[model samples]
Target: MDSLNYLYGFGNEHQTEALTGALPIGQFSPQRCPYNLYAEQFSSTAFTAPRATNRRSWTYRLRPSVAQLGFRAYPLEGLKTAPLNLVTPPDPMRWDPLPLPSEPTDFIHGITTIAVNGNADAQHGVAVHLYVANQSMNSRVFSCADGELLLVPQHGSLHLDTEFGQLQLAPGEIAVIPRGVKFRVQLLDDSSRGYLCENYGAALELPERGPVGANGYANDRDFQYPQAWFEDNDTPHQLITKFAGHCYLTELPFSPFDVVAWTGNSAPYKYDLSRFNVINTVSFDHPDPSIFTVLTSPSDGAGWANLDFVIFPPRWMVAENTFRPPWYHRNVMSELMGLIEGQYDAKQHGFSPGGTSLHNCMTPHGPEAEVFAKASNDTLAPQRYQDTMAFMFESRYRFTPTEWAMQTPLKQSDYANCWNNISKLFDQNDKI
Candidate 1:
């Protein structure tokens, strides 16, 4: 794949030695293009070309790309590590297991480390919640104003009653409920369970193919979209909606999930993560982490991203003269990493499945003593990285640490010592 280069700013010509490059623009052609003195009123100009006008709008101008956008791009300070913000910690005292509604309809209930409180501190755009229930019933109706909801099953199977009709969601399967749409989950087996990611922004989109061409990573056809299904049942059904940090229940005469026969670009869908086309370097070095990105919410600024959801799945590692694992570096975006299973290659100790680590914007984090020693001593060869699966919830905003995350007993106390062992590698005679 060719390196990606961008041309920002006006009045400056930038050239990319790489074959793949993008020319950023400040204004659209035909609207803001330089007018020709001797040509007809509609004569085409360099800026008036159809391609130029289509690529950019007249309201904004282009600028050059920088390694980092600088502090002015973000509102918060303390880029390295923002203090944790924990307004509502997990309260087992508040854990109230509600019985399924006695009515013959869909119902959901469970406990979560994070509550469904409407407070800003309690409600993240990506609220992680757990769900469990028994018996199958009619699908219930629910909607989110902020973003889509991802149902990640940890156990059991779910029969989803969606606009696309009845569908079964088994363990390891993920269902996506788009924002503003109504849907319900019914347990196919005796017991059902899972984790939920309530996305509060743009829907998860396919990453651009760029120079990699149409191959590698997730392909568009691999995505499964549900067909339309609508129900005409008329009864007093409650429709619950979450908006602006508050939950509102509205009594409706029929199931809101009923979309009898609607067809459009907007609809709920699901996909198997296993189908993702994993990309890696076979010879010299590891590729950019972005290669593993499943979805990205680009920032208002061009090129830079607001949030990028990257995954580290099991794959082969065959790089030569490379560390094979991720190299150490401070990032501009705050990274919140979570493990689903197996060990992460970067941090060999402390980080475990179900555990989380936050490397706030610009905070340095990498391999611990154990991983470094093993990598330094291991013979270079074609290696297969197996049984490991991890993910990162990276955001442009510096994470305001939750007090619970910082104070929890689960927090590793010896994390700071991971870098202490590196001092042994320094030598005065090695100074250049």
Candidate 2:
């Protein structure tokens, strides 16, 4: 990938050009673009949405997106859609990482849907998927008309070639590919595996800080957007589109990443997890996990999010005479947690890198018996929780497991036993 030149500021209107003076100044959509490039505006929201929340970008490209001759339906292997419901009682579940693909696979081919919520066409809820790829997406570009993809790499590194520019990401990092952005993922290592969230609601934005004051959690300066880069190749390449829960193939005699210069708030961006401005309690109680939210897709209801991308990064623990582990409780939102690296404080074992645990809405989840015992008796001295990174995909709706997710050998059937080992400590409560 070419060295990236970025336009700083998140959700801010910005202009950039790979070639010097290639961007038209002062206005967008000029009658004749510089260098005779075609101009196009990609709108992520309705044109009349609030100015502060509106997202769109102008691209000066050698060819517009319409250059494809036509779109034909392509099979979406094992990909599932919404309205999936199950009648069983909700349970706290855990699963080891899905085995890496035995057969050769690329990013698009390796994705296997684990669960979905809301309707993609209706633009609500989200989809959870696990991807394992041993090969790169060569001679092809992929576009998701369903929603923007929030990619979390758990293994290997990714070099993304997008219509707007190129971005490279590794484990402990994330990339947000805007809805309808065409891009291809290339493996920078031997193989790749990761978590993907298909957000079908409003575009994700930095969460409101609320009472945390002006700072904490993810900061704007920490978010990085790719600078303008374009493909000028006329070689044949395939373009795939995931639209309305189906994949479509489009043959193009040209490359789609042909934007020479572009500017807009609706573009691909990435953020390093290490850069998150972590917030924690300074006094007695543990703050809600929402305080760690990096981004949220809000719904019509206030304070309710269609999806919340929250993380547990290394931070200080200084609460006075309190259990350091997260308190046990049932919550309104469903949570799917994954460990990217190191050990999560809540689980002493079973939850490892690439492993996942699911606690649906109103399902009880917290530290296992061992973790509870450890935190309950440990001295309440100032300590650092270093060498740990975990994250969660929280949704307003409950998650329905896919057939594969249900029957997979990786499923830990004894996951609930972790809590069973907690002995009766209440008998001595009267004496205390």
Candidate 3:
């Protein structure tokens, strides 16, 4: 909000203070903090994690977090957890845009789990959710004790107030908030709708560019981390925590975001998807979609990822003679794709904006029959794909959808019809 000052760099140890001389020199826990503030440590990673990957923040706040009364069980409706109410249907699935609720809902109440993988208790998987809200959160905060969240707004804008600061985001942009960061989501337009990936594995990091070198894809500088800003309020507030796949509530006399100064790499950051540096073939053949990865949550195994956040943005198709659309085949990774705007080259017919399509592990999925035919016969010319933004949450583990996701009205019943008309093109008698 306040002119949007930010500290740039991913995983860089950053320091910011709301007031002058608020941060003490040389020590994280000084004998006494400036302005008689309380010193606290908020750790995002385990204490024994590698120094390179460890994430902990030192915050100087007016009151310690102990100001809250004991937490009580708070049952959140429509939000399901992994391995519960999940169906392993083998058929490829697609869904239309989620309709806004008729009843008034805020961000927290609007969230509905679509699918979940891995385990929150083990912190090794992810849960995908759809959130649509018509009202703003009033003095309410949500923090995930299980893992971090990668939020993508597909409809209206969102004014996200976090412990770090306020981040304003719209469609084609994303905000990644590390676990345990208290924040509130308020509708910026008439309503706000979005997708959220609750990652229970390692925190998301920028994908490495091995041969592509230092520049390409999402740059670290483009990731905007909010500057220091805090709310010094005494009004009663509600705080909710998602721990062990269950929601818990705590009522505090003041806001949890009362930090006056903080320094840590474990902070929330936002990036505009338009800033991704596109890299495509100037010669022939389409590269693997891994080249489009913006962020990744790496598993312990090599060449395997817990989750890959990939995008198919506007780029040039200048290959000399090649099938411009994606090649047909299914491998190991399960893909959950969402379109933010425009038509996807693979499924121009049924995949609409705010919609999602899925291809489970080793399932046959590619361009539709019409798209395949059109791209196969296209001329060899440099084409600029414009006004399109689609993204995928690909994972090594298969995503089992909840009952709501499988039975919702938005679920397209005839999704397989697009691929049902693949004709025998190789049986040429008069052709060629």
Candidate 4:
């Protein structure tokens, strides 16, 4: 793999050109662009959105996007969207990792939706999917029209070739491809498996630092954006788009990744999870998980999130006189968690790396009974959690499992048994 160049800073207005002066110097669009390249504007937010929150980009391509045409419905099973016509029971759920493909399967063909919430047409909530692929998308490209894609790779490395440029992601890294951006995935290993979040809300932004000040938790400089790179191949290609809860295929006479130059903040970007400066409680009690949020899609309601991407990276714990592991609780926000590398501290077993667990709104969840018993009797010395990377997709709306997810053998039917062994320990005369 070639070492690619990147532009830095989160949400920075970046400019890059593969050829000298391919980008117009004076303004975003001029009457005639340099090298006679066509200028097109890609908007990720509404035109009337506030300046601080607006996201748009200008691309100088070999040919305008309009030239690529001819779209037809492409039926793809297992890939589902929001507002599914199904009922969701208020039960905690868990699943083993989707096994890798036995046959040759590309990223586009390996996606299987697990659960979804809110409405994609209304532009809110998210859909969770798992991808397992053994092949790369060589002549095929994909884009989502309904939402931005947040990819969390759990098994192998991926080489993403997009219109903007290329990004390489491994197990401990994440990448966000903006809505309507064309890209193809190339596996760097023999097989790959990971979790994907389709966020149909406002574009994700770095959460405000609040009293933690301006420096901790996903700093701006850590986000990496691809520099301009393009292929001028004229070979026939295919474009698969997920639009309005369905898949559409378009035949392209040539490669759509022909952008010679691009300048904007709306392109796909990646961040190393290890770069996240974790902020936590060093004094007494556990802080809300919001402290670990790397990015968030805000809703209309203040202090409420359409979706939040939070992580539980390896960190030290020093909270005295309190249970070190997460406590039992019920929450209004829905939570879907995935393990990236090692065992999650909450579950001693069954919750292996690449596995997933869901706790919908008001669904009770926490450490398993075995974990609780051990934590209760263990010493209170400060401990460091090592070799673990657990993360959660938290949302304001409840999740509805898809038919495939509910019927799949990977669904752990005995998930609730983890807490069944908790014996009653309350005593009337031994109250603290």
Candidate 5:
């Protein structure tokens, strides 16, 4: 993949065209579009949604999206969604990385759901999946009507060709494709492994800065959107759509990415995790993990989120007379964590790159015995945490694991034993 140009800003109504005078001057849909192209409105939110949160785009393409043929049921394996039918156990779960495909596997087939929460039909919660692929979607395009996709590459790089344009993504970076946007994923390496979050609730947006003023923690200007680019292929292609926990296939005479120009705020965007300005304590005690949230999808209840995309990036640890690592405590929000590169300070072992761990809502989970002993005895000094990037998909709703996830050999049965060595340290006489 070549070094491609990108449009900056998170939710800006950007206007771009591949050709001159392609977009209408002021109106979205004019009586006649420039160059005899058809105008189509792509909406990700309700028509009557408030102007502040509304997300819609106007595309001028060679042919409208309605030109595609009828869709047929296409049964895809491994992919699953909420509301899951299985009874969810409260046990803590951890798993090794899903191995790469031995045979040819594209982005769609490579996806395997680990856990899910809420319901797709009801438009809430999220689906957590692991994607391991070796091949690219050359003649195939996929769109999800159930939810938007957040891609976090953990192993190799990926080149995405979407209706909006092209984006180059890799580890240490993340990308979000809006719900119902057609796109293709091309591998830039022999094999790729990553985590995918299918957000079924409200679209993810930058969390409110609140007392932090208007800066720090995933600034809006760092978000990179794709510029308008299209292909005019007349050959046959496949459009696979995932709707209501099922897959459907549609045949088309040409590529679905025929939009010559577009103007909208609802489009795919990518952000480098390194750009996140770390906001930590210079005083004492570790702050809440919410401070590291990159994006959030809020639920109906105030202060409660349907899903929060949080990262534990490399930052300086300088809390006077306090434990530098995370403290031991159960949470109301369920957490599904994945390591992108180095060791998460809380769990130095077992949690490797691409591996996953789940601490369901209120389930007892904290630093392992080893991490606990080390952090408790280590001196408190200003230390730069280097070579680590871990992330979590935290949700208000508890996630139910899929059958494949429970039965897979990668599931670590001995994961809970890591805390068995926690000896009783409650010496009442030892208090200073």
Candidate 6:
């Protein structure tokens, strides 16, 4: 037998018969070699190790060999591939509130801005929105679009109805909805809501930890995926999809929320905000607002971020010889801030809860006259800020005032007056 013949199962004359259609072993022999070894050798010798097994007739159909199936078992290539169809929800859909009958159950009203009509043009974009439920209406449905929707519920409990199933999100709970899914929200109690991020890039993935390992903010187990909810409702309904800048609504003859059975990582989920391991300074001054940035959309402009959604939640305000409130300054990114509850340390009175203020790109804002005076003269003791939660939706794009925002009576007439109080504190000797 030659070396090639020996490498294969073909040895001598007996193997030659096995190479033909005849069985390798005769009636006396117990073991029955299915294919003639010689023919199998002849057919497979031309191929490589992994290729040879695939070319084998019996082996090809029986099962893939270890080398041939290794890529399948270890899907490194698939894992590294980028996601297809990355999208952001329309900002207008967020403004549209679903009116429900008055009741005492869990009901909340939420307004989303970043998830609205924002687009990601070679950069990630973040949207800011709010939720206000009078504790009268129990729930509202949120039909998710073709991208990830991160819900930073500032206040109240949210019962999420997702394709997978339902999840109860309390205050400080952060939920993420994958693209192309429909879900609803049920307030566990009457509460106001504030959210910051609207991710348009890769799904709002858990922040990566290099070397340091898992040490801070939002662990994986803290995230809760809804249980499976399988329903067969054949009712006609509209499926609204937001792409580019417009909304495309398709009417389906059945409830689009129908996900009778699905099991995958690509589903809507929620996480507790309290679980965030807040990173802040204990000694000198307040860190940049970016510290509270639950998520950031990176921009092509070097270190500059496209959008940095920041929060000013109730926290310890105890930095000696330092102005406790956000230091007065103008920011390059446009800022749209909303007060969910309590007094904003920056403004003493006019910017009340539920009120909004816009500091367009490069506009100077922060610490109106009264707030500055109080903070400058007050004693520097360890003070715990209580009952206050304010959030900002900072974006890179220059936001043009919407016709409704600019023309509607809902616009605060006294917004410009917020700066009027500054003149009262101007001392002739304090500055030239």
The CA-based lDDT of model 1 is what? 0.52
Which parts of model 6 are misplaced by more than 4 Å?
A: 1-147, 152-157, 170-172, 186-202, 205-214, 233-235, 258-264, 424-432
Tell how far residue 201 is off in model 2, in angstroms.
0.4
Q: Give lDDT tens digits, candidate 4, residues 353-415.
A: 889899999999999988988887888898999899999999999999999989999999999
What total of clashing residue pairs does each candidate reach?
A: 16, 0, 0, 0, 0, 18
Determine which window of 10 residues in candidate 2 has minimal summed lDDT.
1-10
- lDDT, candidate 4, equals 0.93
CA lDDT of every candidate:
0.52, 0.88, 0.88, 0.93, 0.93, 0.48
Q: What TM-score do all the candidates reach, one by one?
A: 0.66, 0.97, 0.97, 0.99, 0.99, 0.63
lDDT by residue for model 1 over 323-344, one digit each (tens)? 7778777887667666656788
Candidate 2 error regions (>4 Å): 1-3, 85-88, 428-431
lDDT of 2 by residue, 1-432 (tens): 335666666788878898887788888878898899888999999999999999999999998777778889889777776657655358898899977888989998888887777888788989899889999998978989899999999999999999888899999899999999999999999899999999989999999988878877788887888888877878898988988888899899988889998888899998889999988888998888998999999999899899999999999999997888899999999998888889998888898798888899999989889888889889899999998899999999888877788888888999999898888788755764
lDDT of 5 by residue, 380-399 (tens): 87899989999999999999
Task: Give candidate 6's error at residue 391 in angstroms.
Answer: 1.7
Backbone clashes in candidate 6 total 18
lDDT score, residue 169, model 4?
92
lDDT of 6 by residue, 224-333 (tens): 55544534465654444444333444445554343333222345555445455666567777667766665454556654665555667677876777877888777677
Q: Which regions in candidate 5 have their CA more than 4 angstroms from the true location?
A: none
Give candidate 3 misplaced runs (Cα > 4 Å): 428-432
Candidate 1 C-alpha error for residue 18, in Å: 51
Residue 63 displacement (Å), model 3: 1.2
- Greater TM-score among 4 and 6 belongs to 4
Measured with C-alpha atoms, the lDDT of residue 103 in candidate 3 is 86
